[model samples]
Target: MNELRSWPGLEGDAIELRLDNIELFGSMMEIYFRHAARLVYNSDEGVLTLERKSFVNGLTEKRQCRLPRLRSLHVFLDTSSIELFVNDGEETFTARFFPHLDDRTILFGTHGHLHMDIEKWEL
Candidate 1:
């Protein structure tokens, strides 16, 4: 069995994580944005989504899943692609997108508090 390793983070804190193999466990709400493309994953409703809000052609992608209370997720972002993994690779979402170079923002919000361990990295 794989041991669950976690780093400490408080609720409503935008913590910086420095690993290609990033881990997110516990109940969470993540809004990850790679430039123009944004990915939103919510555990309460069991949904993962991606959308582009820019001058380029508008597009959206979504994957629905009923995962565990303490779920695992991995995300990869490149110049033209974004990959998302959920629940120890049980569910995955991947797409190619043109990113807006000027702004890249990621937001995380929970039902009441951010009851999850998350670390962000600049890739």
Candidate 2:
């Protein structure tokens, strides 16, 4: 079980994280983004969770989910929807309602410490 480390913060067109030479676990990666960012996981079987607090109505939304072997992923906020994609264009996970307070940050890690080379890109 290796210790988890966080990458630097990015703000621009888009930020991408790439991990190579590492094994992936179901739920072993966390990402924090500043100013609402998207997350994409390309691995065998993985899990994702979102944590945020509301200010307008004092509401809180936290979600955790599992994904099958995927080829790609995308997330973004328009007006009132969170969109997700998987398998290079096979499946997608979309949800309604906004639950992001501020552009805090993004973190990535694994529950069992999967080895990987991660890269964050601004797109």
Candidate 3:
């Protein structure tokens, strides 16, 4: 079981990643997007796997990737496409998927005892 931790100082318009009571059980992170915006994550691993589901019609897309010592990740979203950037723009992974704009909640976790700091904003 994973729980959300406590984090303060969010700008009140963006969502901050909370890790006070949350724990991860896998080597992957999960996030839900509700609107058209960008999502980013940073880690030391040279590889990553992404899993996402659309809020409308409950569709899903999955992929596995090998990045270049991923120190950061950036996801740019449009109405029908998603562009993923890794390592401060060192690499890019792009795909197309449909997710509900109204269901903007995102969930993130890791596969092991991985720790991270997460933040989000509405666009």
RMSD of each: 8.5, 5.6, 6.7
Report the C-alpha lDDT of model 3 over 1-123, residue by residue, as the tens digit: 245223343223223333222233344444444432223232345456555564566555456566544445565555556566655566666765554544434443334454545554444
Per-model CA lDDT versus the true structure: 0.51, 0.47, 0.46
Winning model by TM-score: 1
Worst lDDT 10-window in candidate 3: 10-19
**Model 2, 1-120: lDDT tens per residue?**
235355555323334444344456654455444423334343445555555445456455556556655334455434344555444445555655443454435445455545555455
The lowest-lDDT stretch of 10 consecutive residues in candidate 2 is 35-44
In candidate 1, which residue pairs get closer than 3 Å at backbone N, Cα or C atoms, i.e. clash? 17-119, 17-120
Each model's TM-score?
0.57, 0.47, 0.50
Best prediction by lDDT: 1
